[model samples]
Target: MFNRRNFCQASVLACGAFAVASSHLANAAAVMAKVGQPLTEVAHLDWLCNAVGLTSTGRLFVGLPRWPGFENTPSIAEVLPNGTLKPFPGGDWNEWEPGKPNAKALVKINTIHIFDDDTLWAIDQGEDAGPHGINPGQKILQFDTRNGKLLRSITLAPAVLPAGANLNDLRLDSGHAYLTDSGLGAIIVVNLATGVSVRRLADHPSTKMSPERRPIGEEGRPLQMPDGSDHQVHSDPIEISPDGKWLYYQPLSGPLWRVPTEALRDTQMSEKALGDTVEFVYDTGPLTGTAIDSAGNLYLAEYDRPRITVLSPDGSLRVVAEDPKLWNPDAMIISNTRELYIPVPQSARMAANRGPGGVDGLVRPFKIYKLQLPALYGNRETVPALVGKPLA
Candidate 1:
């Protein structure tokens, strides 16, 4: 014979108590969770590999930049199932040497990507010759991953790619390709069909490195160049949204910024107008690379720390994984199987980071790591299926 009001109050109180308990449990689980525990060493190589690319069909490729020290290594190779690397596309493609005919060979491959159509794309930054300037060798080459046959090559013209232009990263859509010129701080857009290229947002504030921001290395110190200047990289990491509507990018020292893809592709848009369209995304502190899931969540490689953080669509941020071995994780990739491939290039140990040493402090036998993402994060079904659809 309890009163109806009393019973309703009691039920509400019980529900509230249960909710509070559930929340406490969830928080405890998150605190005890070791997201980095699942991270495993997938491939180990003697040379420095900066970028990892996975094809839709599961073929894996790694880009080895012919940096100042490692000049003779293959610019591109396919990681075999046995964890060995085979020079990709065979023959003399990987046999590039100084003063040789490099027009047809791989010069300095800074980044590589494989589309769902089984096309392997590589960006030759032409820095192998010692970052003198952009040359005829600075080109984008596409190959059929299945057959290892060169399909098309598009060279960056001097008009668009000036001297000291370092083409860092690229993202492709059905109609155009977007690239970051880190050296000069600009975004380059290339028409996929016509091979026509245009430089946009040249030295814009968003693309330029923030003078107030400096990168901290795994050693817990500020990274400096040989001349004692702060290690500066402008417009380095680039990513296209899952819907292909927005292009997100930032410098090595960053607060992430983005702009509409429509503005970037608009040939008639004035620089002032285009620059106005850029929107501030988040204050991402020191990032190397980024990948976006189908749900528009961004997985960013935290450069200052050995960790990866995911930014949800709702603007909440959380650490997805952290490992002490992730030293200078460069360009990252998300495979079709929902695994995030991370290449620890140890760039922090490079010559630039070792002040006045002029000697590369890179630890040999660099390792590439892979982490199986939890189901709470996006799975294979949530991965952006940009394969058949036009990215735009």
Candidate 2:
């Protein structure tokens, strides 16, 4: 039932997506091309959306979303090169620190990278603080990747967090960093050394609105089903280029945007200056997620589509892979060889088997799959083919 060809066909539907299909994969191939079979389906998370990252120490880490849907699910996973999925050591899904506020769930993991020796920063969207739908939510927790030790928990400064701000994905600079407040629709800046942070572009037009916000028909018109229902999607997966020259991001719906890293980090610059540098990179009707290659290319997973397209460093678009199996291709990691590893989400399928929160009412068995085809997977140095073991 889950094969590469199903992925290919699924991509066609997503790209041509007017609506998410309710039909089984076996009956869908005639409409789209299928790629190779899913290398494996990872069922460790409660629900998997944007939980993806390839760390420097030859490991791949995945963040899991736990909650009403993902009850008793894993909070983090390390995909070992041997293709096994193992629990992240920091916080056991069942254990919360003594006298601490109740840990609700895992929303999304921004990205995993070695911030310093033996230390890795795991940005968790604690829980969408603004609206009930904000999601996987805003806690920025740090850990020692070496042995899964809890190092620190970074909180939003009162100065930076207006009440009801939900932090999204995060990107790190040498000594500074940036995070997106999808709940509040703001860009948060943090000084790593002092942990002093500030929020900017709270409602910047670049980050919030998009013509791509709505799904488009294959003919480029707003696509909808015969029933006259609409598919509404927003927020997203984002990444800063390797050299930190450009920040490329897109909300779920479309119209990917970017601004020069210099402009974004130039805290001293006027708002007009920062806004001046923010540019509309390109528009896709609806995209599932995006990843940046070391060479400065961005690979976007078209939400309902099969192909993973690239926004070249030079501001051009190219199709990196047109495989059929990339259905619901969501977050991705680019290894050193430029091979892209995407976690094609099967939430729709799992949702079918389990109910809303999934089987057992816990959204059990959420799957994040990996694919290796033409492109860098991310500065590859024998990182696990998939991160299944704890960081050594």
> Each candidate's lDDT (Cα)?
0.75, 0.53
- Residue 125, candidate 2: alpha-carbon lDDT: 59
Worst 10 residues of 2 by lDDT: 1-10
List, residue by residue over 84-183, the lDDT tens digit for candidate 1.
Answer: 8999987888998887777789988999887656677899976443445556588888887766888888887777888878888988766788999888
Across 209-259, the per-residue lDDT of candidate 2 in tens digits comes to: 344345532213333323343333334566776766666665656566666
- Top candidate, metric TM-score: 1
